[model samples]
Target: MIMPNEQKAPLVHLANAIGTMSEVSSRVGQYVLANPEKVVHQTVAELAEYTHSGQASVLRLCRQLGFKGFSEFKLALMAELAASERSTATDSDNEADRYGALLKRLTQSMQKTAYALHAEQLLAIAVHMVKARRISVFGSGISGLVSQLVSYRLMRLGLPAQAFQDPVLAHEVMTDVDKHCVALGISESGVTLDTVEFLKRARTAGAKTIAITGRVNSPVAQAADLVLLAVPIEPLTIGGDISPAISKIYLVELLAMAIADLSHAGRQRNERSKTP
Candidate 1:
């Protein structure tokens, strides 16, 4: 049975971890919500004292959020603030300025994401994909696109790969998946009913399953054999809806490249064995 706190634990742990060292770190989130304008300019000590916490706690909070230190966290917080400002700006801004602002926001998000990706976790995923006899990927909507990209990269490396965007097809495939097969599911929200059901079915059928999603505490993550989490942040808005998709694609591309490199090495090893 799933525990009630299971869904909330990651965020709660994040808060508690920082709070343990400094009371200010726990309060920073509340402070930012109440005083959005000050978020961009508040120093660590100021934020700590304001929350009746210590500077050490503030730094610990930043680390828990996957930043190198307080300065990096401050930059990310400031970037989010700037994006929020651009979204709410009333004055007419030029098209070029808007585009530039959006670009900056996306770049910042991508940088943070790159920093959070664990090399060991990536290598483990690649190894699993390389060893599996067949691979199936599933997702819906935007995440379906990511699934397709994963399938495409695996196929290019000469592996048997397939992606199902349709729920019916995904369910059909899951029924026959075996121990030699692997299933990869991508979902940012981690609560997509269709995707979760398909993954559950795949696992029941004895296939190894992996999940790539934003929330570590999500049910989808709990159901998979392996879970890779993308740290969550506020949705980025540019002049339109394009930037968020582009930013997500950048991270997906990195995942694909890592798998491809590992698959290629596996193929080389197989060729040498056949020759001997």
Candidate 2:
């Protein structure tokens, strides 16, 4: 799908700025705006040839427009095109008639989650996991189940960790947490009072806390030292639906992979240092 020429799309902005760019960059930008369809489908080499500009010029144009690279620029262009198509498409009157729309929404939600995720935060959490002498995961309901999965995965990685759903037992465990402990709380709504209390208690006990929730402003988020958000979707959901649980699992898997990678890298570095 191609965006309307009248719209103020990302490419339009680049085209608008053509007057302000260097001569070579201006050539690349002008070619992109003039051949927007080609820009979408063509590789950097192909696009450069079409624009009669060097690859460096094309890359410079992307950088000048604040994109990290050509691939990111293309992705942004595609997103804008998708938005345009959605805006122009006729709506389905009923939910059942909009199955494709629902799927699209779910896909977009995951994409938005990826965009919202902060790499530095994940790295910081991984570092904390490596340093912590013990890890305790806490939650209730669906989130509690996800917490248990997280604990299981961490233990499988040879990390000392456990999960608790009982608020009383979880709190009692928090009392043993100290500077060397990492307490993780998983709550979709972020308003789970028991989870919040457990995090608060753990933090007060001098342990570092992490919150995995949908709402950043919730009590649980405020109590934790680090927050990792999972996508929340409850519209038109049936009772006891586990749609949001899928997102929670996705986030936990990401954390587990990061922790494993960091641990593996550390071990390899240690082995290298011990080499004769």
Best by lDDT: 2
List pairs with backbone clashes in candidate 1: 22-57
Candidate 2 residue lDDT tens string, 118-176: 66788899889889999999989888889989999889988899999999999888778
List all candidate RMSDs to the true structure.
Answer: 10.4, 12.8
Give the range where candidate 2 is weakest over 10 consecutive residues by summed lDDT.
1-10
lDDT for predicted candidate 1 compared with the true structure: 0.65
Question: Considering only N, C-alpha and C atoms within 3 Å, which residue pairs clash in candidate 2?
Answer: none
Q: Rate the local accuracy (lDDT) of all candidates.
A: 0.65, 0.75
Query: Number of the top candidate by TM-score?
Result: 2
Model 1: per-residue Cα lDDT over 55-165, one tens digit each: 877666666666666666656656556656656352227777766665655665555445445566677777777778889999887778878877886797777899999
